[model samples]
Target chain A: MATDSKQFDFGFRNGRLRVAWYALLAVLLLVGGYAMWLRLQGGMRSTNLTSITPWGAWVAFYIYFVGLSAGAFLVSTLANVFGIERLHRVDRDALFAAIVSMVVALLFVWTDLGRMDRMWHPFAWRQVTSALSWEVHAYVAYIFVLMTELYFSMRYDLARVAERGTGLRARLAGLLTLGRRQLTDESREADRTWLKRAGIVGIPLAIFMVHGGTGVLFAVSKARPYWNSGLFPVIFIISAVLSGTALVMLLYVLRTRLFDGERVDRDILDRLATLLAAFVVVDVALTAIEALIAIVSLHPHEVETWRLILFGEMSWSFWWFMVGMGWVFPLVLVSKREWRRTPWLMAVAGLSVVIGIIAVRFNIVVPPQIRPVMEGLPHGSYFPSAVEWATSVGMMAVGLLLYTIGAELLPLTPLDGGDH
Target chain B: MSSNDAMPGVPDTPDRAQLDAMVDAEQADPRAELEDVDFSTELGVAMAEDAKAVSRGEITSEEYWQRYDDLAAEEFGEVYHETPNPAVDHDTAQTIEDDVAESLSCTVGSMASIAESLEEPAGDSEGASEDGEDDDHRWGMVIDLQKCVGCDSCSVACKAENRTPPGVSYNVVMEEEHGEFPNVQRTNVPRPCMQCENPPCVQVCPVSATYKMDNGVVNVDYDRCIGCRYCMIACPYGARYFDFGENYDDEVEGAGEITSPEYGVDRGEREPKKSPVGNVRKCHFCHHRLNRGEEPACVETCVGDARNMGDLDDPDSEVAEMAASTRAMQLKEGEGTDPNVYYLE
Candidate 1:
């Protein structure tokens, strides 16, 4: 225990910081719990949504988390499948985040459902034509792939840790090892093989089935012309990769600085920054092209949708969160070699991208709905109600709580010196 | 000539015990016993059958006598006497006739049944399922824009009949005015569920909860609906609405006590977060009313009488004829939804 403590801290070794983090999470859960209770009692009435605006903040959050999960999993593939050596340090972290984010995404969707009890209906009764139904199955498959990858990636480290001591962490690690305590080279090689296989399967599952399918769910809606473009799904994929890479970069730097008591990996941060910038460039180009076409077409609904995003009441979300933070600021920060060298600067860029993608999701969901499909129908108006914001925060806290507990108990950090 | 001589083919073998037993049986059920009796002629058989009907109280004696008086005279000539039945209570028969008349004028109950029966042939013409199979129809509607007064009565009728919760209107009227202040033309377009042949809502339902019925109406199976509102997003016309469980308890007393029988399901009492309360609901062309041979409430209650519903499959039907006219057009036709509802300019 002394040696392990000397080497690295899992959560916050400073007991006060740990307590504060837990306390913050606990407070959020308490508020969120009350809000969720109200939501359950009041049903859809608690929401400001009308028939014209059937979806709201929860839907945006759902897509946001889906993009995050897909992005994180794709980042993990950088090490597990593509064998990027520097990325190996955060591959397991990214994989775990992917699992947690996916669960959070699904939780958002479940709460958004009118019949939360009937959430299983999508799986039990398969509607071949529904993109959502296909997504339901894909999410299950993706989660399975993620868990399998995470298990194989950690088994060796868990076995090593389990053999060390009689403490609770050791006992937990021993149980997680599933009695496969054989620490032979063959077992390590076999674990790598399983991880690679899972990652291979998961790449397409994450890209085409999970996030791309969510894009298709919108694109297929001929009612909303803004989302009907062929490029929508492609943009979704690119943005997902961008967000995932950014989240992982942020996680790596934060973990190194706060918990691991180690110097941040500059090489990995540089590569991730470059990859994230590339994604951002692609995302910006595609979005610009999409907007240009909509503006040129002069189709009323299309124009109206864009107008809503750019100039409507909620336009601040687009200009500030999406364009400023999501695209411009992050792109500028990551563009410079000197800034990329600064680990905290890279973290800020990553944070900006993460926050910006959330606005991107909101723009995707809310704008098109603001313009009524047919004119003279009451124009839809919406803002996330109190319950909505509270529940969203609570769900995010849940994800953080899960990740915190997992990080403390599991061998998520690489068991090596800072060189790797 | 005696009655027996006139009917020479008849056999007469009267046993006192059998005759008494037969008479007793006739008292029990005149129609059943009379079936065994042999008559001399068709007229005799017809008169005797009616006489038995009168005796069993199936028909009033006056109705029976009025029916056979001329026929009896033709058969029996001078022997036919216009004698009223002593067994029938004339007072009771008069009271029954009076009650029927009073009930028809005083209450909707009997009138509704009468209306139902009167509508039977119309229902058949409108392609009500003859074999109790739904596939025979493609129900349709045609609205004349010129006739619409823009009163929103159709919307009101729809709300009243469906008892849809707030934020869940199955019908709406889109009104617009064109041209300058001096010469303006106002247009009111009443919208209901288009019941599209290729409904985007049905195509995107994750649970197959909302589906296009063979009868040309799109149905939302509330039991199966998870209420994701995907169909609401998918629909081009914005025809679908989610029932958020809001009721008119404040304005109308006992509003929640009785719910509209939509899709022929009696979803009694608008309970909070029940099947329909949590489900996406829309106009099913008043399927419950359609099942009972009645028009959709919007069509029935349209003050201007602008709406007409009929079998689109039937070329001779009013809606089909109107739909075929040059003035007939569908909203958002470029979307290729192939809406069942048509508007005549």
Candidate 2:
């Protein structure tokens, strides 16, 4: 029942379950709000960032969510662009996830700026060589494109739900539909065509401008050898595909099976898990090649940074979380023919991969920066302060809260993928 | 009383045997050392022996000089003019000048005369002013390795002169030891901003808050800087640093009252998390000091006289001359930054 975007006939019943969900969301909002308050009051001093390690947990989360959003958007294209009816079930969910993650990412980066008040400068004074300046423009444009595409995808559903209901959802749907009461085959065909075009155009934009460009933010830094390479942005794209696939898979299972306690199709679960397993292999392969290139070059500066990532203080993040749970464990669960058929195992694999993606983001940001740019200068080390951790958790909670409220108030799930 | 107190003992001169051994051991070429002086060993010995008499209250210094005058006239009766003494101090300043000149590609005689004329180096394409003027005085420094004792007075003086807040040092000393323990080479590299002709810092600054000045110094416009700190990551030398609104409030006295007039802006009072407080900062070759016809704080306070600052465009300047020396090298030439700072290894 919760697997689709268009609402079904069943209402938000089961008062106790609704209350429990709302309570969890409310607690998250309250606690996360307090942490956010501390951050605003204290400035960057509330974080563990130093002059040496300028970017910390916030920057990590900023990129992590960006990957997830780009990943989710691209996953939606599998249905809208490629006409994959099997994946149609998650299209609206994917779009909503994309929008929410982008919001979380933008906020994280906005606050991470040294002069948060002067955030307008990057827009006002655009320099040609500055990738960061270009990023602002691209991110804003990407958001507009996402919202427009999402509106097109949901217009018919809104019109349908509005005709049948007379409560908050109906009123909101009417206002959103702009008073267009008629629904016909011609209009529905036009909506499908527009959606297909939007998805097609958005594919390259999501792959290159949004996620790959974010990778370029670090790759262009000649000072940090770890990130300066042609392969970096490519790795970012592949990993985005990987994490995006995992996120959609996780959300699908939670929405359908866990929260709603409904049965899901075995074919969808197996195929999604298989896609995730394949992405993990590709992600790990790219990482191995990157490591091999760095290790064999024997450049002390480059080697030291790699060592910091592989065996230094936060080595466990790479060795355990990213490799063991993120890749190997997920790979084992999904690739095994017997386990792949089990819906719970597929969900577990999806959950492990989504958590591991966060670990990937941290390793990418922290380790290279931890090694001093020069030999004698103080090497950086960072563990996000309690406030930083809380704020990040709060932001994640906020993402969930938004998802929950959005799920309830809007037509997020329908029986026929909102087509009829 | 003064003479007696000065030379109370050792009144009697050493005997011939003792003098000869002392001469053989310590004065292998006594005459060479003695040439500039009045050449009278007898008069010198008599004066030394009489010093003991004076110390014993046998005679005064005045009386001693008066008694030795006839011998003193023969001992020190020569007018000497300054001349190169290769037998003693082998390398004079003139010789160094000639050697450095000889090594340069410029005509040997021309290089010697270059001391008086201001001209640019042979290959000076990089670091031209934004206005595309190459004739402007591009300030530069040359750190001499032999002279740099690495006392880090330069770093301290930079802090005091710039009045940078905590964690905002514009200059730093990087030290490392290489080779085997028995034959280890300890090297100290005192790093300031490279002030590259094609600075990556200036290139990456999204707001263009940081820029290369007409004088070839890279400066950050604190008022305009958004504190993105992209420059810090782009800098190959790690010279650019972020001002994370940290202060020496607890560590230093009256910390907030101290702030530099950087970029010639009177940003009064280092408020907690203000313009420069949140902006990126770096060495500007002490442009504020330069406007006042003074060298950088690091150059002014270097105990070893290791750092030299002058107009690289002015060939007559010491920095220009040293920049042309064979030992002169810049850090990270592969980055193609073309740093104005030179290191004489």
Candidate 3:
């Protein structure tokens, strides 16, 4: 563990590195807190929003994290429901990350509201006509399903860990197991059934209601022609799968090689990279078809939106971040079978997709809104203000901090008779 | 004017208190200084009581106008003809007379058919039942583009009446110029909330806070609104504006003392993050004024008199007649919004 990249180690094994990571996240949280304070005190005036461009970076980030969470949850289902044993090593960790990502996503959306205090209004009232209302309820339901699935998967391990010791880990495990100390073969079987059931329920919820519904939210707005296509939701689900696969891959590689100093699991890494590459190919095809339809339709609004994405003021984001890093670089790195087998190189590709998908979300949200809905209204122009950036960074730090803490406390690794 | 900062807990600047006192004095009720005054005529006495009832919402303005239509005409003579009232029920005889008048005025059969269509129940009207209210009145507006001089007075009038904050304009005049230098022509398009029969803002509102009223105006319940700004994006007219909590504290004296009487709710004092301050706002056809039997400020103040307001459900209403004219058109007609606002292009 004492290597040159010790500075980058995110594993909990190194005491000094753990403290450093905590200190870094604490600092970031403080900075984000200050930005959040400014946002609350100044209200929407703190941002560069106008009636012309009411939405901005926070909305993009909201959808981005929602995609990440959905993707991560779907990845977890691959093992828990589909019975893919080799994938179990990362399934529990992916579930934990999914929960944290959802919290972060909700926070980003909360900050975007003009009346942040009214965040609960969507839940309190129901409007069947609105896609966003359905999304709010779906997010809550999805989070509960994820927590239930995680609890069931970890129940047997937690009971065993609790019975074997009397230290802090034992006490934490005993508390988490909710007094269910009977670790019989029957209980284990029951836990497995419950876990499978939760996973099955979550698959459709994650695909159709959570992320796909997020896509439907945009698709239903016929006013924005760019997002009104039937392909929009399909593209969203595919990209969600892509980003989720990449995030889990990056997390696994970083934790094993840098943090734990354990021998990396080559088979799992190879499978993950292959899955990530396949998702990338599908995502690219869907995007091309979407772009082709928009261009061929020659509808002024649709044409204008694509034009803005391809060559507008923020075109560099599309070219460099979305297309170049998100699609081209990752595809190239994973294209060769030999490179896909390299854990570190595959991690790099995964990292590229994770970063690139952020740009993808931004491009989806912002470009379509830039063109005025009517003929002669002012064209929307937007760049996230300083407060927006600071708060977003802070929210990301919050998610990472929760993840780091979860990794330390939970028995997330594969069950191997207790001793690490 | 004394400098007085009436807003409590602020470090008082002497001049602020004086400014507040001056504002209060200026806003003092003129009725407080008057004694009981008797009307000289029976028609005047009856009309005064009915006006109060109209303002109080017990009776619609059309009801009051209908009661005194003959008397008003007799009292004012030729001068009364200058400003025609649309609420007067035009019977079949009057329709026949209007047919003759229409033949003399211009050649268009569409108006006759439109008037005929209004005789049937509105249940068959497309998109009318989508809002699920089949009320008697559906307020509407019509603007004559030829009469519009691109003065931007409508925009100013709207702001003055609505007391909108910076970057929030309920009405905006979008201008565009066509052709090269010698043959150049400028067209000013004054845009306001279409108050569509099927408003997308209403459809997309997650909280059901923004909705279509029975009177045909789209309204936002400030207290119920969550301020997510989804409606702003959904509105094809770009009529919706999010109040970013910006204030006119620097420019206007006592600007925050009284909120606009929007929907007749006098939301007192402009405070950051308050209901309407954080809500999505748009033109409601000057609904407060409409309740008071007055036209929207833009219609009243237009120098060219380009705008007309009336009950579109009434076949005899001026707005309905204009809406049936050959030049009448609705923006984004293909969008299937069925807007209550029309323009003579």
Best by DockQ: 1
Candidate 3 off by > 4 Å: A1-11, A417-420, B1-135
lDDT by residue for model 2 (A277-391), tens: 8889899999999888988989877799888888888889988889987899999888777787787777788889888988999998888778788788888889999888888
Enumerate residue pairs that collide in model 2.
A4-A413, A5-A412, A5-A413, A6-A413, A6-A414, B38-B75, B127-B197
Sort all candidates by TM-score, best to worst: 1, 3, 2
DockQ of each: 0.60, 0.44, 0.55
Candidate 2 runs further than 4 Å off? A1-14, A258-261, A418-420, B1-135, B179-184
Scanning candidate 2 chain B in windows of ten residues, the lowest lDDT window is: B122-131
Number of the top-ranking candidate, with lDDT as the measure: 1
For candidate 3, the per-residue lDDT at A309 reads 90
Question: A1-420 in candidate 3: lDDT tens per residue?
Answer: 121322222237778887888999999999999999999899888898888889889999999999999998888888889877878888888899899999999999999988888888897887899999899999999999999999998888788767764467678889999988887989989998999999989999999999999999989888888999999999999999999999999988877764566777778888898899889999999999999999999999999999999989999999999998899999999888788888889889989999999999999999888888887788989999999999999999999999887776676764551122
Q: Which stretches of candidate 1 lie over 4 Å from their true place?
A: A1-9, A417-420, B1-135
C-alpha local distance difference test of each model = 0.87, 0.80, 0.85
Which digits, one per residue and each the tens of the lDDT, describe model 3 over residues B116-162? 65543332332443232554679999999999999999999999988
Better of 2 and 3 by lDDT: 3
Ranking by lDDT: 1, 3, 2
Clashes per candidate (backbone, < 3 Å): 0, 7, 9
CA displacement after TM-score superposition, residue B122 of candidate 1 (Å): 14
DockQ for candidate 2, C-alpha atoms: 0.44
